[model samples]
Target: MSQDYSSRGSVSRIDASISVPVRTFIFSSLLWLLVASVLSLIVALKLQVPSFLGECPWFTYGRIETLQRNAFIYGWASNALFALNLWIMSSLARFELKSSWLPVLGGIVWNLTLTYGLIQVLLGQLNGFALLEMPKEVAPAMVVAFLFAALWPAVAFARRPTGNVFVSQWYIIGATFVFPVITVVAQLMLLWCPTLGVMQALVHSWFYQNLILLWLGGSALSAVYYFVAKESGRTISAYYLATVGFWTLFLFASWTGPATLLGGPIPVWLQSVGVVAALLMLVPTVITAVNIFGTLAPRNGIAQAWNNTTLRFVLVGAISFTLSALLNIVFSTRSLNALVRFTPFGQAQEHLAIYSFVSMVIFGAAYYILPRLTGSFWPSAKLVHLHFWSCAAGSLLFVVAGLTQGWAAHGRTDFAVSALPGLLAASLLLVGHFAFALNALGMLAADKAPSNRRSY
Candidate 1:
């Protein structure tokens, strides 16, 4: 019953089976992206003009900022991952999802619960933790919903009919297992059961970093591994290095969280361990960079980077990953951490990771996955280009502004000087998101209008 999953000429059984669920997740994520972007714009505007929403309690910078970030993480990022990872795992395994209704149901529940949580956030009912800000009331439902959505991927991998396990599968499977564990532990320790004094911070830090690196970063890297090879028509160079990279990331990434509290109330030994673990992450970074860039080597990659939209996005994501990793290592150092602890540079590093590295890779994967799933080419090539540039430019501008703001901490006390770039970044990001939403929705619309659909 097994068939090769490599053929893209027609929708496979696997694609057919998962289509509704994947589409559900994708559309939900697009809606959330719009919500997050608007919130982001409001946040940026408030930064620039503090009195803009001063009268509204709901729009207060503190509350809205948390709302926007959570909306992005839980809403945009999580749903996108569900769609991408589901397709990737099922495609790689050549396994038809027997219970497609599971993910569809799960996606609905997840989004509905997240909506309620965000409302609570606006009402100031939050945990006050970075990245884990959603009210504890919503945690269990979201977790259960995620498991329902995510379980099929693991089943596909374990029950795969043929072929050796790919590196991308390794990352996906690892993430599927790791995320729930950390999320449960963090919620229990930080919210449900509650931990003692500094331990709460420690758990939050551990959970936060792993959520970024292992859960989110793991899924992004999985996409990168698959797309870079698929688009380049070349096997990942130095494939053995992938094992090293994957294992190193899985083992070391969890410990590196403590480094965020280097000078804080955390134990010195724990901080030192985090520092070492963070530095060790360099091993995987260099390994991944070599494997990816090496595969995209010579003139072929350069040409693909220009001609292939998927390759272009994946390549930029690869570059961003390297930069984010390097910046992470740099910031983990004691001297630099002391200087930039409470600064915008820290936020800038996060923006680079979430927006530039993870989001770009997901975008590239979506471009490839959606067309295959829908049996249609993108609605307009122009919209695709516009989305890419707007997002790329916006991400760069935000990161640049953050770094500059951090460095100018001593000299720049003026609000206008600090907030102007952020406002511009937010505006560009909003435009880019609109372009993406239109293009994505148009593709779905074109799918319905068979006369309008184009060949892949």
Candidate 2:
């Protein structure tokens, strides 16, 4: 939040202790982000020109698209969370991280496992379930590595020196504990011990929804809660709502997944339950909006929000999160579902939730955390600006195009014509991701440069 950002100091011994491991995870995440961006562009192009990579089976739209999503989720997003959340947890708990090598080693193994799974996916060895496309063989390794990376944070939370726990810590630790359980359930039911009929779909939907809303969404909210307070120099505006919001999000978001299976092979009762739960999502969403935006109101003016790089990204993300929640409720209704189901509307919703809301928050957190970890400011403010605008424009374009495509489908418009905007959006995202990667790498390099070095 300070203009002299280069002088930002580490908050605790834990931050200094975990610097190397956190940097390892972040660097790996950047590489995977580049990979995902390239794949995204390819997949977007192939949607328009099916024969774009005609001769190569591995580059087929299905494979490339799946790989892109997996790389973004497991490779990019998960790694970033591991780095950011672990640090956030330790700092909040005022506990030093022990066995830093554990996270470093875990990050290495996790990425390697992801690499193997992605290769297998390209080789047509996918498990065929959405978001759980990675082959069953990789599941054990992924879980083990996740545990290794997650251990210190759990220890820090449990052994905190102080009795006072922050809202961010509550959300972070909740997400950390929930993910492995949901993931293991998904793996066991979908892959290891296959379920019968639509139960498979039910399980996958449940897992996917929880992964997005609980794990990814929860983590992003944690960052929002911390940074909003940090940057605004105030406690959260609606501090009392924080507890209710936390519990409701976890309680209701889990049941909302079955709404995705509306009018599918699932039973009507279950689908109805999901609809009710999805509508109920408004409870937490409204609370979050009030808490974040209320705290986000600037004492100066609009210019202040725009000038603060982290606040800019976080504000966009907070707005997107609220929008996503509303859209999800709309889509959950049977009338709207019938209109847009099987079209690109669902994908558009996912894009808004993940890229616009979750990834934007992650980017904002990275901008703040990397400087502290590396003891150097971002080397290029222009690149930071570039990254923000490109991603913002791209996410908007993609979401608009996707929703337009869905509506067009209902209007009997040509699919080919409808997809053109998506191609353009993907191209912009590729550029944004490159800028982000370069900027991050530059910061990392600056950390080691003789002139930038300083004692922690």
Give me the candidate number with maximum lDDT: 1
Tens-place lDDT per residue, model 1, 247-282, is: 999999999989999899988999999999999989
State the TM-score for model 2: 0.95
In candidate 2, position 208 carries an lDDT of 92
Give the number of colliding residue pairs in candidate 2.
0
lDDT of 2 at 111: 95
- Poorest 10 consecutive residues of model 2 by lDDT? 1-10
Cα lDDT, model 2, residue 136: 93
Worst window of 10 by summed lDDT in candidate 1: 447-456
